[model samples]
Target: MKDFLPVLKILLRFVIVYIVLVLLYQFYLNEYENDVVDPFTRWVAQQVAFLQSIFGFPTVLVDSLKLHSILFQTEGRFTTRMVEGCNVISVVILFSAFVFAFYKGAKTFLYVLAGLVILHILNVLRIVMLNIIFIKYPQYERVGHDYIFPAIVYGGVVVLWLIWIQFFALKKTDKS
Candidate 1:
């Protein structure tokens, strides 16, 4: 029984943190009108559009609230849309939960903060790349959206967790 206690504690922490963050996010979504895009998603879409525009695409961002997503248009032609899933909030919540579960010290919060920012920026780049793919090679949209981008985002989270465990969570070895 004693051996299982630590594992159980970590599990509980993970579950509790995950559930609380998800509930908070759901509440945030509920506070917004269904016809309007939620603020976080809107912010992510804006970042994606800005980056695309920087690439000379002249991207147009449209908050098609009725559709529950932000639309991207280039030169009056619709390119793609960014749904709530593209916002990376869910991933952020998950990453945070994991970090909180295996929390090491005061520095853990800083790691979490840095992870969130890194994931946010990576997601923006992913969306911008997806938009370009959708515009240029519509046929590969499925492969890119469903497989490639998800790998990039989730794989990044895994790497961050591994790094945290290796450096922050683990006590350093004696080096004489």
Candidate 2:
């Protein structure tokens, strides 16, 4: 019991931090939805228009969901809302904190950052491809949204986490 006290303290600290972050994110998301989501969504629609014009493709922005507006283009659609918790930045921050808490070094930090960037870019591309798919075959929208897209986005995150754990965390221990 005595030896476990330090470990318990660490776990408690992590829980407190995680809870605070979650609450803050929820508050921010609520405020953002009320104030900024629509305008930002309109801006995204404009960008889609410009991109469609440039690429010579048709794009549609749909308000099917509540949290964020979905943009549908010949290539793909993504949400325009830059809500802090909805996008990759939040993922990066959370994962970086977790990794840093466990690994504790500059190299680990950089790896996490790189992974986060990769995940974000992939997410953007995924949205584009899904939009294209949705436009080409409207019937597939349900399948794409419910299964394919979530798998791609969340699966990408999982892969990134594994890479970080294996190459960054485990590899160093193996070498030592």
TM per candidate comes to 0.94, 0.64
Model 2 misplacement above 4 A: 1-17, 36-94, 173-176
Report the lDDT tens digits of candidate 2 across residue range 1-176.
99998667657655665667667766766665644354433553555445654665666555545545543534455423223233444555566555654464688758777877776666555555555555667788778767997687678777877776677655756447
Task: Give the C-alpha miss distance for residue 89 in model 1, angstroms.
Answer: 0.4
RMSD of 2: 5.0
- Lowest-lDDT window of 10 residues in candidate 2? 79-88
What are the per-model numbers of colliding residue pairs? Answer: 0, 3
